[model samples]
Structures are given as structure tokens and as C-alpha cells.
Target chain A: MKYLKNAATLTFDPDRCTGCRRCVEVCPHCVFEMHDGKARITDKDRCMECGACALNCEFGAISVGSGVGCAAAIIRSMITGGEPTCDCGAASSGAKTTDCC
Target chain B: MINLSSVKKKEDCCCTPQKNKNFLARTPEITGQAVKSLSNITRERPEWVTGILNTRSGLVPIVTTEWTRTDRIGQIRSRLGGYRMNYSVRPGLYAVGAPDSSSDVFISANYKLSFDILRRALRGISGWILVLDTRGINVWCAAGKGTFGTDELARRILGVNLAGLVSHRRIIVPQLGAAGVRASVIKKQTGFHVHFGPVDAKDIQAYIRAGYHATPEMREIGFTILRRLVLVPIELNQALRKSAAAALVILIIFGLQPSGILFKSAWTGGRPFLLFCLISIITGAAITPILLPFIPVRSFALKGWLAGAAAMAPLVTLTPLGGTSALLDAAALIFFPLMSSYLALQFTGSTTFTTISGVKKELRIWLPVYIAGLAISIVIIILYKLQSWRII
Candidate 1:
């Protein structure tokens, strides 16, 4: 399913793309496509900004502000004051398991 | 004693002296029986661990592809939102079949479901499973949160002395984990080349058979009807919990007759309100997700609102509230749709495609509208109550 239009933070620089196709392979949303021996952003809005592309890119061709998109987590962070996380009580207790969404 | 010292010497060359000491300390009763020695040295194993395989690194726990009755029960419990976070396996190295040092190493998250699915997919395959500590989260969510990340992968690789356990330099990581793990950085840190496998564990065998090449379909994440249906139980559970408190508040508010509290008024006036709450819950948490693609709107909140409106329309016309007070009917229509909208918006967390930026934008615009609608509805309810009481 799609979400808000033009809201994704994903950006790509074709000049730095080595056309390794790693970004095209890793993106869960199929946001990247290869054309003329170079990777291109075919569906920028479809990007969830999970940073899979940027992390896998060896030539520094991609950038995005990646994070969890849960509103409950964001609301919790506003109250608890920290990075948005769904780890519930585990974050404070230094526990390995969490009872969260 | 001679063999112990020889093993120690080999370990010293591969890992730190402290780690070697810790390993020796954990295995105080190591004996001469090669097969039993490794298992005996390891501490108490979990129930799922059927046996131990003697490997170059040490004794690794062996797990079967078959699911135990307990495993199936736990899966159902977690799906129903019972002890979801607690359903996790201990993170470490495990063995499938009779894998030797030359076997391929597959990496996974410590979440029990994720680990189970992977092992199940490996049915007849013999391989080494390297599970990373992701605080009991699934691979995709853990990767997004950066727990199934580069540092952890590298650290786990060294901590287990993986190089000593495997002949090849290649380790197969789940493709979804690419969000947090940088293969290039992992190679530089651990000297093991990261080869991303298919997004789904079921495709792993096919991927290996195709010379480690994942077709485009295997790489793409699919939000099938089955997947969406499985998530509904948890969503419905959470929505019901919140709705309980809301129902109580509604009953109390309607029960207030300016004559302290009246059960008669609560039973009569609050019935419609309670029904509205139930309808909103189902619309937002259940129907919205199940019919996500078929829904006309792209924004989840709007879809929920529309669905809520459609469901409430029949109730509004059929119920006594329609004839008694126009104001109360208007309030019910406005407030319940907004409630459904808010609930639907929360589903962005469970979805695969929503982005942080997109959800933030949705909240910026829709949250204020929801708040405003709620305020207006409450005011209308108060006005209708006062009119009936003849106070205004």
C-alpha cells in the first residue's frame, strides 16, 4: 500500500553510482532500477527510507533519513524523550527482550 | 590434558586470551570422548536443542527442521498478542543436519519465529546458523532499528570465531538485513564477505541452487493476504484494550443525568456510544488492513475514516439516537470516524511500505484534525445534554 505523496527523504546521485545493482537488489519497495549501466531512482515516493540502498551502496550514491514509521513509537518518544523506538520497557532496563508493538 | 592444551593453543591464536579463558571456564568437565566432550562442556541447553555437533570452533547446538508441539503453540500465542516480546530464542551459533567446517553459514535474528522459519526452510540442508542478538525482534524490524546491524554482525562473527568454524570466507545474510548491515564494512571488519540471500527464508534453498542469485521476485517484499491476516490478531487485541477504557468513559459521561449518575440513562444513551466504539475498532484495526489495497484512499487514516463512516451510516439511521436528538447523532458520526481514523493511522508501524517521513507528514496534518473533531463532538454532546436538562 502507498502512503503520503512526495514525503520520502530518499535521494540518489547517478554520478556516484557504479551500477553494482546492490541498491536495486536490497530495496524491499523496488525504488531503484538500472538503466544504461547505471542505477536510477524509478519510484522515489515508494521508498520507505529504510536505508537498505544507502547502506549497501559502495560508491556513496544514495542517502536517506531512515527510521521506524510507527506512530505509536513516535508518540511514545514524545512522552519518554529519546529516539523513536518500539522496544517498550526493554530500553530502560537494558533487557534483551521487549513487550512492544 | 594434552588435548585440552592443544585446543587452548589453537583458540589463543584465533581469539583473545580472555575469551579463551572464559571458554575454558565454561567447559570445566571436558573429557576425551570427542562427540560427548563438546556437549558436556557446554552448559544446560534449551529444549529445542536436540543434540550437539562437534565443530572446529567448539560444540554447537543442533536444531531440527521439525516443529515441536510447544513451538506451534508459542507461534499461535504470539500471533494472538500473548507474550510477543518474550517469545525469543537465545542468540548464538546453531547447527542444522551434520554440517562440517566447509558448510555454508547462514545468518539470522534471535527472534524465535525468524530463527524457526529459517531452520524449517533448511529442512534437509546441512549448514551453520549464526544468530545475532536483536533483542528478540524479527529480522526486518531489527534491521530497521539497527540491532541486526553491521557492528553486531561483525562482533558476533569474531565472538564465535567464525573463521575457525568455516572454510570459506562467504556468509549469507538475509536480504532484508541490508537496511542496517553494510556488506562492505562487514568485509573490512570481519574478513567474511557478506552475500545477501533472498528476502524470504523459503527461497533460500532455491537461491543457493541458483548459485546464490536471487530473482527479482524473491528480493521483493510481498504483503500477501495471509501475512496481513496474521497481523490482524495483534492489532485487534491492542485496539480492544484501548476501546475498553474508552467505553468506560463513554458510559460514565452518558450516565451523568445532572442527578448524580443513573444506570437507566447509561444503559439507554451509552448503548449507541459503545456500539460506535466497537464499529470503529473493527473498521480501523481489522477491515482497513484486510482491505488495504482495495480501499480507495492512499492515506490509511482516510481509508479508515471512510470505512467507519460507511459502517456507522447504517447504525445512525437504524438506532433511536437518530430520532431523539440531531445533536447527539451528529456528535456520534463525527467522533467515531475520527477515532477510526486515528486507529488506522497507527497501522503504519505494522506495514512494510510506509516511511518515517510519510507517517510524520500524516500525523502533522491529520492529528490536529482529529483533535479538532473530537473537541467539536464533545461540545455538541454537552449542548445536547444541557438542552435536555433545560439549563440553557
Candidate 2:
């Protein structure tokens, strides 16, 4: 099913991309497409900012501000009137992340 | 949680010292086996049981019984406790229904719920369950995290001696895992072909029967109301904790109200004030989530605002407390809706209903409004208390 896209958090710099196709392998959203032996972000809005591509990318070609995009985080920010940051609570352990996954 | 101490002391081939930390980390598996290691298991005398074929690769334990389908008790336990986390299987290769040289090797995450899900879906089917060490995370999510990636598959294959067990070189993984598993890289590293199957486990039999071809419906994933609703309890649990803290803060503030010389009171009719806080929290955390689909609005924050106002409707009209101080009443009106809106905003993170853009848009427009309203309400409430105290 189609989902929401709020910001273009994902950016691809061809200069740094090694064209290893690792990003293509890691992105569940299919945000990246390979062209001319280099990785390119075809669907900018589709990036969930999971950071798999950025984490696995050897060349630092891919960058995305990945965080918990669930309502709880947003609600926490709104309630506390705090800056946007991941306050995912306990439910987050179900989903693994590159930091220690 | 019950068997951590008992299981911690027990050491076997699976619980080797080298793998102690990792084993301890797989708490769900320990609990599962502790709770349900079937003593009535009967095997079909599979050749691999006695270590018939000698291979250089490490030993791969095969689960024969209870592999064909999920145990009903475990299914019930998972349904009840899966959201609480700490539910997973031991990450390894398992033989389901007497899998052999030609049986399809199925890849699964270590999460017990995910394992049970596919096993139940594949009910009378025989296959080799090649589970990845996803640290109790599900396949789709682990794939996103790259735990279900090519390297893990290749490593697991080597560790389990999968090549020796099965003649077929193809591994069938869920379609959702396509993101992290580079099919080409898997082939290069493990000499095995990766075939992504249907998105849902229920479609596995059909996909395999139809020569590994997935129908359009099988490929599409959806977030229906039922699915969204199931996630509410965990969110509610977390919200209750946070709201309790908020409630205490509210109680302290309201209880600080001045008492005149006539009849002493910490709060001059504080029940209504406390009720307002309850309405705000319940509307945001519970009501908004239940009636999410029916509520019509551009953004979830607005929908919450509407629900919060509706909750306060009777209090606004029927109750005579607002007549005492207009400032306190106005502050209550603004604060209740803001609380609901903020709570509603949190649901976006847990649901598939919202997109990144929808959220960014909502936050941009509503966050500022809520902040301003909250600030003004706090000021008005403080002023009302000050006037009652004859301070200003």
C-alpha cells in the first residue's frame, strides 16, 4: 500500500557512490536505482530513512535522517513541546536498527 | 523472564561458552523451550538424526515434530505476549515435516511469532526452516535493519552445513526481505540462488504450488483497521505510563489553588479539574485510536482535537464549574484539546495510515498551534489562581 512522504531526507551523491549496489540490496522501499555503474536515488520520497543503505554504504554516498516515524514519537514531541527526536518507547525493540542490530 | 536463572546455568552444545552471551540474549527461545519442550515427540527416523553424513561445517540441529505446524499453546501465548517483546525462537536450521535433499529451504527470522506465522501458513508442507539471527526482530523489520541481509544468510548457511543437507541450491525468502538481501551478492557469496516469495505467509503454499510465482494480491501489503487496532494496546500501555507523570503534575498544580478564610480547601472543587485531565488522556490515547478510520479530517492531530472537544461536550454544557472563573474554564477548554491532539499525533508513528509528508505537514501546522494554545492556557490558569489569591 502507498504510504506518507513528508520530507526528502534521503540524498545520493554520485561522486561518492562506489556502485556496489549495496543500497539497492538494503532498501526495502526501493528508493535507489542504479544507472551508469553508480547508485542513484530514483524515488526520493519513498525513503523511510531506515539508514540501512547509509550504514552499509562503503562510500558514504547515501544519507538519510532515519528515526522512529511512528505517531508516539510525534505525540511525545507535541505533548512535551520538545524538538523532534526518537522517543519510540518500548515497542521499538521489535524493529532492529543498524546501531546494534 | 521466569526461566532466565535456570536456563542460564544449563550448558549444552547449543549453549556453548563461546555463544553464552548470544544465547543469553536469545531470551525468548529459552522461555519457549522451557515452557514447551514436547516430551511426546515422535520422529520418522530421519537419516540426519544420528549424524550420518560427515561434514566439515558445524552441526545443524533439525526440529522434526511440531515443525509441520505451530503448537496451539505457543500460538495463544504469542498472540497474548508477542507485543510485549521477548518472544523468539533459537536461530538455526530446523527440518519441518521430514525435509530432505530436495525439499525447499525456507528462510525465516528468529522471532517466535514470525516463525510460528510461516509454519502455520505452511501447514502440511515439508521444508527446511533456515532461521536468521535477527535478535528477535521479524523478517520484514530485520531486512530493513540489514540483519536479514546477504552476509547473515551466507554465514548461517555455512554455520549450519545447509549445502550438505539440501541438494537444491535455491533459498526461498519472504518478499518483504528483498530490500536487504542482494540476490546477486547471495549467489556470489554462498553459491545459492535467492528466490523472494509472497509477501504474506498464507500465500506461501500457493506460490510454491504455482512454480514460485506470486499473484498480485500476494505481493501487496496493507494496513487495515483490524491491523491498526491490534497495535493499540502496546501504545496504550506506554501512554498510560507517560500520562501518569503528566497527571501527577496536573494534580500538584490544581491542588495548589488558594483557600479563603470561610471553609478551607486545597482545591476548590478539584474533581472537575482532575476529570478534565482524564478526558484529555483517554480521548487522545484510547478513543482517537479506536475511531481513527471513522474520524474525518486532513490530519490526525485535527481528528484528535475533534475527539477531545467531543469528550468535553457534556462537561462544557451540563457542568456549572466553568461559571466560577472564565480564565480557568477557557484554559481547560484549550488544554483538553491540546492533550488529545498531542496523543493523537503519537499514533502516526505506530500506524501505516500516515505518510512522511502527511506527518511533516501536520507537525508544521499543528505543533506551533498547540504550543501557543498551551502557553496561553498555562498563563491564563496561573493568572486565575493568582487573582483568587489576591496576588495581582
Best candidate per TM-score, number?
1
TM agreement with the true structure for every prediction: 0.90, 0.69
Distance from true location, Cα of B128 in model 1, Å: 0.5
The local lDDT score (0 to 100) that residue B15 gets in candidate 1 is 18
Off by over 4 Å in 1: A77-82, A88-101, B1-44
- Considering just chain B, what TM-score does every model have? 0.90, 0.76
Task: Write model 2 residue lDDT over B81-134, tens digit each, in one string.
Answer: 343256666777765664568899899998777887777676687777888987
**lDDT by residue for model 1 (B70-141), tens:** 888888997887576777887889988888878899999988989999999999999999999987778988
Model 2 stretches with alpha carbons more than 4 Å out: A1-67, A71-101, B1-83, B257-268, B318-324, B356-358
Model 1: per-residue Cα lDDT over A3-70, one tens digit each: 77898998899999989989988988888888999999887778888899998899988999887788
Computed on C-alphas against the true complex, the DockQ of each candidate is 0.60, 0.19
**Clashing residue pairs in candidate 1 (N, C-alpha, C atoms within 3 angstroms):** none
Docking class of 2: incorrect
